[model samples]
Target: MLRKHIPITVSHELVHFKQSPLKKEHTLLSTSIREGAAEFIAGLISAETDGTLAEFKGKEITRLL
Candidate 1:
């Protein structure tokens, strides 16, 4: 079970790692963007629809961003 999700987990953490060095300070918006980018990148790489996370790949958040 855990192993199956490792790819997604690793991708998420990789995004964080890539962004970590550039950030000067942590803030709510920056954290949200980091987390959101992880999910978005993972989804793109996987190319499979995960019902649990599908709700996020929508227009609502896109408009806000």
Candidate 2:
């Protein structure tokens, strides 16, 4: 599972690097949005989504629903 996610991880970090004016607010909501954006975009860019497993969690929940 960890190995499968590496590409997404790298892409996620790269997305963070390219992001301008990185948010560093001291609240959970802000942090969640910032990280979630990276994860969602990274999945789209990296093409490492779990279509087979249908985890239906996190980023995929909205699409699944």
Candidate 3:
């Protein structure tokens, strides 16, 4: 299952990279919080950029309660 998530993980990391430069504190965020936010934004980016978030819908269960 994890093997199938490489693209989603990369997308989330890309989102984090885009946010890193604008965050003022450079403080560390918990993995859950950081990954949750990245996943959410990346989902939106996927929907907009690729016309669907289906590839990442399953990953949401990990980040959302």
Candidate 4:
């Protein structure tokens, strides 16, 4: 589980990095938006690649939502 999560987490952070330059505040709102978008993308990728969105479920995803 933890192993599977690493890639998704890293991908999310990477998305934030790509978006960071355009973001102004980097405040809670910005952070949540960046992270949420990343997580959604990562979930999509995971579902496409791994054939399951199960990794995107549970506590972490719930918290993001």
Candidate 5:
């Protein structure tokens, strides 16, 4: 179980790290993209690429953009 989550967790953290330099408050769009990017990258690295962990029925976070 823990092993299964490693990809997504690491991807999520990476996205956050990339956003750390943002000097302004986060907007809904930015936040959505951040999470979406993490999810996307996670999917790419995860063995289960069917997007079962997605909040919606899409492969990318473009739905929120």
Candidate 6:
């Protein structure tokens, strides 16, 4: 399963990279929100080899991307 969907993972990491600011302090809620937003954006832009992954991802994110 991991052997596939590398694009989604890359997209996810890229979102994190887009956060140019290196904050010294932030609340847990803020950090969680950041993570969640990254995930949501990545999912929107990520691709699927077939419909299978699209369906699977809709249910749950197995891993990165």
Least well predicted 10-residue stretch by lDDT in candidate 6: 47-56
Superposed on all Cα atoms, model 6 deviates from the true structure by an RMSD in Å of 8.8
In model 4, where is the ten-residue run with the lowest total lDDT?
44-53
Instruction: Report lDDT per candidate.
Output: 0.69, 0.74, 0.64, 0.65, 0.66, 0.72
Better of 1 and 4 by lDDT: 1
Model with the higher TM-score, candidate 2 or 5: 2
Model 6 ranges with Cα > 4 A deviation: 47-65
- The best-first sequence of candidates by TM-score reads 6, 1, 2, 5, 4, 3
CA error at residue 45 for candidate 6, angstroms: 0.6
How does candidate 2 score on lDDT?
0.74
Write the residue-wise lDDT of candidate 4 on 1-65 in tens digits: 46777777676667777774754646888766766687788777665232355866764644543
Which candidate number maximizes lDDT? 2
Over 1-65, each residue of candidate 5 has an lDDT whose tens digit, in order, gives: 46767666777677678765654887899878877776776666764432454575565556554
**lDDT winner, 3 or 4:** 4
- Give TM-scores for every candidate, taking all chains together and pairing residue i with residue i: 0.58, 0.57, 0.41, 0.51, 0.52, 0.61
lDDT of 4 at 2: 62
lDDT for 45 (candidate 3) = 61
Q: Whole-model lDDT for model 1 versus the true structure?
A: 0.69
List where candidate 2 sits over 4 angstroms from the true fold.
21-24, 49-65
> What ranking emerges by lDDT with the best candidate at the front?
2, 6, 1, 5, 4, 3
Q: How close is candidate 2 to the true structure, as a TM-score?
A: 0.57
With a 3 Å backbone cut-off (N, CA, C), the pairs that clash in candidate 1 are none
Q: Show model 3 residue runs off by greater than 4 Å.
A: 21-34, 45-65
Q: How large is the C-alpha RMSD of every model relative to the true structure? A: 4.8, 5.9, 8.4, 7.0, 5.7, 8.8
Q: Residue by residue across 1-65, what tens digits does model 2's lDDT show?
A: 67887887888988889877644555788778877888789889987752344554565545543
Clashing pairs in model 4?
none
* Clashes (N, CA, C under 3 Å) per candidate: 0, 0, 0, 0, 0, 2
